[model samples]
Target: MNKLSVKVKNLVIGGNSPIVVQTMCNTHTQDIEASIAQCKDMVAAGTQMIRLTTQGLDEVNALRVIKEQLHAAGIHIPLVADVHFNSDVAIAAAKVADKVRINPGNFAQVHKDAAVQFKKFLEICKENNTAVRIGLNHGSLGEEIVNKYGNTPLGMKEAVMQWLSMCKENDFYNVVVSLKASNTVVMTEAYRLLHNAMQEDGMLFPLHLGVTEAGNGDQGRIKSAVGIGALLKDGIGDTIRVSLTENPVNEIPAGHTIANFFESGENEILLDSVMAQIRRGSSKPEAIISVNSALCGNTDTRSQDAWNEFIIKASCLFGPLLLDKQIDDFDAVPNFSHAHNHDHECEHTNEHSSDHESNDAEEQIFVEMKKIFSADRLVEFKENLMQAARRKFTHPEYIACPGCGRTQYNLEQTFNEVKRRTAHMKGLKIAVMGCIVNGPGEMADADYGYVGQGGHKVTIYKGKTPVLKSVPEDQAINALIKIISES
Candidate 1:
């Protein structure tokens, strides 16, 4: 079987090459500046390639302008034009862009001369020395394949193979294949099956990886990471894109971060940076307010009512700040308390004195907050927090096993603590395993890990590379932390 290996400009896409991370621009192609600005920004943030929609003549004209501007700026990164329902646009884009991405699912269904249209499109790409991405989306699978195989992994793989065969038949070999399904399991399974089938058939076609309609930032990123990350870990994917509903700018970073994980094995550092930014931004108080109102009820009920009133007043003060900053779920506030530990002092203090002190304390707290968080700084802080919250899977990830009777000291507890402490740290995976029996294998890919042994001894491994043979249980966390922090 031929190994799947293909090159895009200077970057290789398969056969032991590091997976390429890519994204598409959502900006209107006619708005050249906006689209180019976004493309440049994504490129700067480490996106390996950019894809843009070239739907009609207007978009094709825009592509030419955008390509000229990018070339002038010395950005020679590959640009792919996504074409659907139109082969002419594909031909036009092939003239300018470095690559053309076509959905065979739709293109093959176009007309009786669909194959001829595709052949013409391939000829244009070949003349331009442009690569072609045979993007096969599950949502648009060919009717015959779907009917034959019920839209399962087998069906998806068949669809891809059919298109790949067509490409070969037309003597178009500068091709990459992508089989995408919104369902993660289906996506993963389909790719695995396709990889095996291609290998068996002795086909050497590079694969494009993605989960289409991956929803919003948070959920979409997580799903993409898991699906694509798993495949990359297994040496399956050649190029990858994380589809999201959010801004295209956001997609670039997420793609780069994932690529960075495999390229440098530095996911922990990325994860930590994201977490720290989240913690810092999350710690800020949304509001501080002074409220004075008489309550008519039993002491407990009156206290509850006063607390509710205080919360309402505080939310009113902070609501605008939250909205202006685009912070979600800002209405939820952290708990506050002013209780003193010394009961004796509280008893000795006069009731009137206590009331006066409480009022004074509230005033002081409000004043202190105002002093620390000026409006400008607060806005900046919120901006930083939002950036942190933005989904970018550039962190060290772990797949630690839960401890069992093969066991050691509180594996779950240690795992939680390590995760908490390293939450703000990125690109580091620390596995806390129950025993050495299966621990080493489970944590083989982990950057740093501790596998428990009976009676206080544990084995530590780093980056699927074994380190110290054994260490005491009590010292494992510190040792792991030190190694991760240093790394």
Candidate 2:
């Protein structure tokens, strides 16, 4: 079924439009200048839409000024207000932001009250010609939905469908919907279920695809690519956001890589070739053991962007197969030949000498293999890939939010600390969240969580129960570590 397009300012999402890539700002919305600066950076990085954290009325007012300043500077990029647990804020933000993102599950306390508030918010959105995203996360499903569907993909679909029903009843169509999860299997399956349900209902709203709480670095990228790529492969996703714990600007290039790979029409040739390779590789036992030159496809791993592109391609190729249980493990190490560029070697070895050390062809192969795909590096990548696919867990799975204005603490630094300290522990889903608003609920599946509370405090949780509350910011990590160790 053809999806209905939702327009946010000059950007059109869904229908026959291109897959738009977007990112959210982490700067405090109250700091209008910093928000504006971040917005400028995000825009320069090719972000189609920008979402800022809007937690209260004060932030809404700040958002107004930020948008005004951006427009005055000739940047008409659509600004989205990400509102959670507040209906009134969502309504107020609709008038100012080009789009308003709300998770209806938390719009109000009571389910019925949420419906009423959501309707009121929709009325305002319609009046102001603002786009809406009925964004729902797997870990944040409402109690009622969880009661009925056990917090599974069905629950997510059922919850979002309720809001979509309200939209249909109210004749509101300028809306996009998302069901994000950190687990690639859950994320992809949820979207697929929702897509089929929408098709059955005879109206398909555009999907905003993402892997929520996907942590930083290569794992984040691979996990996001796997989840979002699976959905896009089935012609499901409309707009994509590669959420990372690092700088939001880094998200744009990663998002674009995934978007470009699955883009329709002209890119279909590349997509088919890659998909065919994945299919062939996953089918036979012999194919599974080796990662040869052909497995890398035509992507030349010699340029500046080669490593990043390879990560995207590798995830896209192997993720689906692993997620679907077609292959359990790959035995042999990938040994793609490095391009014979001495300059690239110098960049790595930091050697200015042109006449470098001499080596035979066999010795050179060993050197390249050791430098690029060492045994330890291969194991790390495999473990992460396995964890991303949810097939195995050899290391602690980190679920972290990309810091937003609500994040009062140094989220990136704190999360890294949590990861470093907890690296030795295996099979634990540890979450290092930014703030209390959505942290506890979003990290519902985590065995342990480190949530930031305001006023330089932190809350430690053990499976939805607050084990330690109001620990000092400096001591929170130690407390969390102790709790995990004691358990």
Best by TM-score: 2
State candidate 1's TM-score.
0.55
- Any residue pairs clashing in model 2, and if so which? none
**lDDT (tens digit, per residue) of candidate 2 on 388-485:** 88888888999999989989799989988898999999989999899998899888689999999999999999999999999999999999999998
* Cα distance off (Å), candidate 1, residue 445: 35
Model 2, CA-based lDDT: 0.81
Once fitted onto the true fold, the runs of candidate 1 whose alpha carbons sit more than 4 angstroms away are 265-487
lDDT of 1 by residue, 186-206 (tens): 677889999998888887688
Reference-based TM-score, model 2: 0.87
Query: What value does the lDDT take at residue 462 in candidate 1?
Result: 76
Local error of candidate 1 at 321, Å? 42
Off by over 4 Å in 2: 110-112, 264-305, 330-332, 335-379
Error of 1 at 114 (Å): 1.9
TM-score of each: 0.55, 0.87
